[model samples]
Target: MKLAELAKELEISTESFIKFIQDFDLELSECIATNFDVKKDFEKFAKENKSFLKKYDADLGQNKSVEDIAKNIQQPKDKVAEILEKDKIKVYDNGFYKSSISSYGIHQKLGGNYQFVYDYFGKKTNLSERDFIGYRDLFFFISKTLDPFLHLAPLTDWGIHKPAGIILYGPPGSGKIFWANKIAEIVDYQFKQIKKYYFGTSFVDGRRANFNDFLVEMMKEDKVLLFMEEFDVIMSERSEEKSVSSCDEETKEIVLHYVSQFEKEDLLMIGSANSLVDIDDEILAPGRFDVTIPIFPPNAHERAEMILHYLKENLSKDAILMKILETNNAHHLPFWKEISSKMKVFSNTMIIDFTQSLKKKIRDIYLKNSSLKITINEKLLESAFREAAAKLTGEYLNQVAQFLQDVSINNYDDFPKRIEALKVELDSYKMVEKPIKTIGFTHNGDQES
Candidate 1:
């Protein structure tokens, strides 16, 4: 059964059920397949926790104002407003808070007794684990995409087969390659990179090589996830108006010929592309490279966690840098939130760049003043921040904007909050002021509201 179907049976909204899962910190993989199929465990849990689910649905479904939240938590309205303001939670013009703003998180922040929620649900688990930072939504979405491989229901019941090809599309430095490998792990396939030399006609070792022959050998192997980079350029739209390279043209033809045999042969091909705008329609049709997952830059919260992960995880516990971070509460998420807020739309590479720059500066300062305790302050952070943000040039901004456009068309419903967050970040770079636009997918086409 689908998650929506389960929610309907339980007499609650699908949105509320999803929120409940998130608030209670349930493992998405344990609850539902990427295709929204209700896992047996989650279905059982929901039915058994009937009373708790109703209360959760009632509380979270309501559009809450400061007074409403204050009353529920037995706090003064003024105090609630102050706490929300300090935490940078937005209050909508209508006086109610945005639905995305978690009242449960706020309740805990303001010292409300949220023990009942936790006691019933057991201890909550964080969505972002050590191996993966954020992108819980993306993880769930991709899980569904891998359903044909992960479960037999999709194939046996729905006649859906494993995709032969998938394209991971996003701006530069968004970690498309990382996701390609992750897909391989989830499907339990051997991850192999298809080097550029194997594309068309090239020499392998000491002999002539052809991509078709290479693909044939790969098909002979047991369960392989073949990753190809520069996919957009290699499989660009074939048009008479523009000149197409012989190699690229031939590569496209060979892939089209072999893609059908991939699923039966237990071969999965993943393409990494920076943009999807130029890719040919045939490459995106069903039974081809139709599955496209957008790899977004880390959000504000993710940025903070990522920075802290890079800094503390890399340094020794008793290291001077660790001590410096400790002094300023840099070990905590709150301390990094302020700095991360300034780094909207920064890719993972840029976050690493910030950490690298910050580390070097800390090292330099400690060297010059060996006897003195080096303080990590705004002055030092600002310098490193500026250096890291240098890559946020106009060209990068344009690429992000294009990514937003493409994702809205393809996966809007799957990631509304991310879309809005990225749009706000992208708009920050605009020279002229414009209201943040709500872009949604419609049956007709993309409509702005």
Candidate 2:
């Protein structure tokens, strides 16, 4: 839809749409000469303009002209032009007036919607619950780093080095790959997934040399995120002495050179590895990876939420069983997915009974092994659910929940003292949990056991 067509549809005048285009540029010939279909161009322009106008609606209400609004927003004229062009608004004549179509603008186009790998997974595949602590922090850090570049001209230097690199290292299934994809989506950067063979091949075969060329071309395209999974292949520490024939030193050297180039050019680079301990120290030095984040396994609270989300999508009726199995496995995504699939195969009534039986089995297992009783009361369960939900949503509500859960579960003997200590820490965040009151002893009546 050209801006004029959109305006006509919305009952807006041609003069108004032309004025919007003029705010971006005066050269109508160049703007409309590009090859874009009128409807597609108009849709693109409408989306971008909606976002921009919403952002600066107050200023627009002041009745400023397009030029004045662009100046006030500090956005480039080309960007404004792109937005207008997307809306099907175009320059007629040199400055005179004629109606014609042209190419759509990239800047005005909306990036793809936020998506997750689990979305594409089979319905039967139960994805593990996500641990929100690391995910939220990771998102915040990346957002802060990329915010400056999002709205400005591609040419404007945000002091971002080409090939800007970030390393995410942790255990497998710890959400490293998921986080990388999410970051690319959030930042509106193109993600190029690099394969392991690209790094593992012998230099003599030209594999090592070809990788560098590929990266250089990718960087030149501007605002691309190069994601290297299993980065350990290229970044593992070199042996004390050089190894012969089978080992290739050229691969390491080529990787280092490109990494250095990326750092210098300001291109974004993101690498994922199962363990940082095995990675070479040289690759982790300041310039190569400006930031390193660890994606740790999910905690109890996160597990609960992961279970809940999985159940809602896969087994909506079996809430009780979902909680029990999730708490027991609380380790990774696959387990949740697996159990959920099983639960779905059974009858609804059977699902409830099966969940109860599972909970009993888990409790019996714990009871037989331990000297101390680990009771999960309503209060504790509620706390875990809340914490997990907050993390999943990327909200930082109470920082102390994680610490308390760790202390309580890992150190049962000292739980009381630790809880007291945690209370002091929680005070800092204005989070106060009442002490669990002991009403009476067990039915045995031996001092209310």
Model 1 per-residue lDDT tens digits across residues 360-425: 999998898883377789999999998888887767877888899999898886777788788987
State each model's CA lDDT, in order: 0.79, 0.45
Best of the candidates, TM-score = 1
Q: Relative to the unseen true structure, what is the C-alpha lDDT of residue 277 in candidate 1, on a scale of 0 to 100?
A: 93
Tens-place lDDT digits, model 2, residues 215-319: 677768866777888676566776756342233355556667777666345467788865555567777787676466544444333343344444434444345
* Residue pairs whose backbone atoms clash in candidate 1: 34-144, 35-144
Error of 1 at 9 (Å): 17
Clashes of 2: 30
